[model samples]
Target: CSASSGCGTGILANYFDHYTVFNKPVQSGIAVGDFVTLEISSSELFSRAFMLYIFPILALFMGSYMGMRLFPATELWQISFGIFGFISALLLTKYFVK
Candidate 1:
């Protein structure tokens, strides 16, 4: 066994040390999944939602489109990007959310 038993606990612990603040916590409430909605002119809320939720989706779509670029599209790029993004987001959510 490596020093930490190959458990990745050191990396995991470091991840929480850095990211645990970005996610809010809720226990047994309707507000658990609720993100504060933005008023029309509120750029900060919009930016937060885009950064946390929408931008990644859009980027993946763009990645696939850019790969095709008016040619017949292939599944290779989309699949690879999707798998990578899923793994990344899983780690991020685990790290940031208690």
Candidate 2:
């Protein structure tokens, strides 16, 4: 177990002979080099995937649509709004994922 990025607890382990690092809580009595089991629910995985991938795209499209309606003469405004929306969604996703 060791400190990961963002100062969270993490574990470095070997899986399928490849070294991988996971940011997860460690139980008491567990030590480095000890074997442990990790499990993730399908629903949780799906939710995370959707938030990380789909949500930002949806936000960008919505923003583009709104910008087009509000600024019909300016393509620049539409693209700016879409980029802003994508960035906002990423920030929100980061906050919620934790």
Candidate 3:
């Protein structure tokens, strides 16, 4: 793995040439430009994927449902609430999920 940024005595790794994996624990004697094997559990991966993909959708649906129950006369309000819910979910996930 190649070092992306140096933090204190540790280095952040750039994985798959796209994503940066931070706060990784490194073993002694491993230095910059060295190849390393990273292992992630299936359950952990699934949970991360679910949080990234499913949570926002569920929030949007719930928001739309709330909008329908609160304002049954207007389709515009329902759509607006759904969009608001979607955006709120995205922000929550980005800041709070990790």
Candidate 4:
């Protein structure tokens, strides 16, 4: 959407400028029309990032540990349960994001 009406254009522009994949500097004042944008605070973005990235790994580790504890001699069970836990964490994250 155009910033002519003074929406969140600045915040979005600044975010893109600071956080591009190639680390190239981006100019501000870029605008898009017909594109939906959700406004979120930086802290919220970081929190969500942590949940999206870190939570699944942590869940996998915990799940594998628990699986091992439950089935000490079964290596397959540990791997299967770890993968299951990771997927479940991701699904939960998707549901909460929506």
Candidate 5:
């Protein structure tokens, strides 16, 4: 877990922990029946993490820059723009994933 990125797996696990609707059961610690699977490679995983984490940060910077240009150099407006940028990045990420 330490040698590689496991945050995505951790997120899935936490989600499953709270919502049993997607949980599955195995009788002998083995997949014996219909099971869901995903075909993802390590490189793809890393790329996804990179996009998810870095894109928002980049958007934040761009948003702050635009905010500075459009509004007064006030802390509140800068933070608001940062948040808007993050949300826009998230929306874009969702679209890309689909």
Candidate 6:
């Protein structure tokens, strides 16, 4: 092969070698619209699967803060605070990393 032809072939070979890594797939999961539509479409769904998924998180914070104030010296109080702190950090990382 000519000098230019050899270089062109080398570049093509490099591209093919890395194609699997370089062509990684999209990482999208469930969309927010589906959540919204589910809640809108069925009252049972809003109470059952949707609320079940959502409420533990809401309860975690609500119960944690109230427990923090109510039982300041308890070991369980410390655990609640730790969980609250951990969730906050995870949420912050997710928000800022994007």
Q: Which candidate is the best by lDDT?
A: 2
Tens-place lDDT per residue, model 6, 1-98, is: 24535696556565554332233343468563443221235776565543444545665676677777878888698567657755765565455432
Q: Candidate 3 or 6, higher TM-score?
A: 3
lDDT tens digits by residue: candidate 1, 50-76: 565665676566655654554446777
| Candidate 1 global Cα RMSD | 13.1
lDDT (10s digit) by residue, model 3, range 1-98: 33336542134223324556678779999999999888889999888777778989998998898899899999887888898999998998888767
Which pairs, if any, clash in model 1? Answer: none
Candidate 1 vs candidate 2: which has greater lDDT? 2
- The lDDT for every candidate, in the order shown, is 0.57, 0.85, 0.80, 0.78, 0.75, 0.56
Q: Please write out the lDDT profile of model 4 over residues 4-62, one tens digit for every residue.
A: 35766555565554443333344566554434344579999998988888999998998
Q: Quick one: ranking by TM-score, best first? A: 3, 2, 4, 5, 1, 6
Candidate 3 Cα errors over 4 Å, as ranges: 1-17
Quote each prediction's TM-score: 0.36, 0.68, 0.74, 0.59, 0.55, 0.32
Q: TM-score for model 5?
A: 0.55
Cα RMSD for candidates in order = 13.1, 9.1, 8.8, 12.6, 6.7, 18.4
The positional error of residue 14 in candidate 4, measured at the CA in angstroms, is: 22
| Residue-wise C-alpha lDDT for candidate 5, range 29-79, written one tens digit per residue | 666465766457999988898777899899998888888778876878878
Q: Number of clashing pairs, model 6?
A: 0
Best by TM-score: 3
User: Regarding TM-score, does 4 or 6 come out ahead?
Assistant: 4
lDDT of 6 at 95: 57
